[model samples]
Target: MTISGEFLAFISLALVAVIGGVLLLNLTKVVHMVVGLVFTFIAIAGIYILLSAEFLAVVQILIYSGAITIIMLFGIMLTRHNDEESDSKGGGWKKVLLFLGVLAFGAAFYIGIYNLDFGTEPAALHEKNTEQLGVALYSDFVIPFELMSVLLLVALVGAIVLSRNDGEKEGDKE
Candidate 1:
């Protein structure tokens, strides 16, 4: 079988996503890690678009790549942290072990699913997906969605209050 453009795109996006995740885990700086996370988020959004979920792709980009990453950056800037790097004598060995473990898991997963066939045709779920999503979300999941929003708001307020208290304590000692 010949390689299709869609398959190539998927492979590229998946590779980028995996690389971003690895960078996020291995990076030393908080800002760098956030950048890696943004890369991963954007790649995932691309995959969503490839799968014809335009609404979900846009939401992924906006919510994850834009809002969440910005919030994380702001948190990193507002928090006090030391710029010193700790000496890790055994870090190299840990990295090697982690790499081997990841490879083993990947091989196992690939072997398990390589020859498996679902024998199913693709459904036209992309048609009216946004409308369907909106209807389901607003009608069936309205209460849960509103509750989640309120919970997030409370968490944001609590974070601000706690940070302000910490700032006041620092002022007291000065």
Candidate 2:
């Protein structure tokens, strides 16, 4: 039997998620880990699109993949004294536990999916969804959005404060 459009989209999203998760697990280097995270974010955006939340998908790509990942890479570069020495070692029972954890998670996830009763009717697409989302954000969700902005500002200020060389008085160092 031929798969429906929705089923194909779901399968594609699942494949992306699996690939991203595997990349995240196998990569030892910081940069590679970040790249895996980007893949994961992209996969999540794809899932959001499958759910018909296009605005959320775009925001997920923009914020998590674009902004946060760049910020993380910058932080890593700024903080590391020796890039070559910073790479973490790979070995031991940790890998075994990680594998087991992933196995258990997959089992549980499959069981949950098997049990859930999704409504038979599919949702109708709203032509003005973007506009409705904007209205909702500015009117109903304004306070939470403002709070998140303040939180981000605080985090940026904290990062700056932490990275500053406060003890490096120029005359004293010489």
Clashes of each: 0, 0
Maximum-lDDT candidate? 1
Model 1 global lDDT (CA atoms, 0 to 1): 0.93
- lDDT values, one for every candidate: 0.93, 0.84
Instruction: Please give each candidate's TM-score.
Output: 0.84, 0.74
lDDT by residue (1-174, candidate 2, tens digit) is 888998988888878888887888777687887898899899999999887789989999999999999998997776654435444467557788888998999999999898798789975565667888898899999999999999999998997877668676455575
| Candidate whose TM-score is highest | 1
CA deviation > 4 Å runs, candidate 1: 115-122, 166-174
Q: Once model 1 is optimally superposed onto the true structure by TM-score, how far is the C-alpha of residue 157 displaced, in angstroms? A: 3.3
Distance from true location, Cα of 103 in model 2, Å: 2.3
